[model samples]
Target: MESPFWDMMGMLGIYAPLALGAIGSILGCSAGGQAACGAMLDVESGYGRLVGLSALPSSQTIYGIVVMLSLNRTIEIESAPGLFAIGSLCGVALLFSGWFQGKCCASAIHATKSKPEIFGLSAAPAAIVEGFAVFAFIFALILAGSLPAATGGV
Candidate 1:
């Protein structure tokens, strides 16, 4: 019989992606939102754009959700290691990407506040950070397919 500890680890692995991703998104959004609010005080007519830019980091949470769903399965001793490896690593990637993306968005917002002409260009760095998150998401999905399936009658 499998130990309870392995089962618990498997469960933690299953949920880690979503939990970490959400935490990252929260941090990213908070940073960007604060910048947006500060910029709003300085700018007169582009509050909408600033607010929208602040939301750029939220996509990492969505990627996390997709990864969590992809990794979802019955806990088994055979699958636990794979689950933990893929989910935790993917979650870490997402966490960093979201956090950095938010910082990028904040910089963009601050820069654009003074030079609205560069608004679109300023978003490029944030988009690049998002690309890294997508890479992690895709790799997680691909690797998740290789985990051993749970045995019936557990």
Candidate 2:
């Protein structure tokens, strides 16, 4: 590829993940904070468990990075431009997935704290959030398959 194209993609490759990571961090932190706040609702309740569950949302951030790296390796030059856009979509999904998961976990934490007896109900939100991560990862995997074979040899 031309210098500019590679240059731009190279820059994007780095910046895109960075941005997603930053967003995930912020959202995760917020989710933790919200969970903490929720715990306060019932200090005598599952304060520890609620906090731990709330923190679960932050896990997606690391997963996002892993997905990005995997996509980078999976996508070859043959696919080129098509893969680029799809990869970007996955990256974008990472950012939003973190946010959604965080929110859900936070809400779940709150619910748990308020109704410790119904922890299962509280866990539902986290499950919902997981759907987004699954979708993003599955799409990435599909897109990787669609990528054109690498040109020449490795």
* Leading candidate by lDDT: 1
TM-score of 1: 0.95
For candidate 2, give the lDDT of residue 102. Answer: 76
lDDT of 2 by residue, 1-154 (tens): 5556654664465346436755865786587677677577657645667666666656556655665564454334444565566556666777777777777777666666656777777777677766776677677666655666545422
Poorest lDDT segment (10 consecutive residues) of candidate 2: 70-79
Give one digit per residue, the lDDT tens place, for model 1 in 59-82: 988998998988888888889888
* RMSD of each candidate relative to the true structure: 1.8, 3.3
Candidates in order have lDDT scores of 0.90, 0.63
Error of 1 at 50 (Å): 0.4
Measured against the true structure, the TM-scores of the candidates, in listed sequence, are 0.95, 0.76
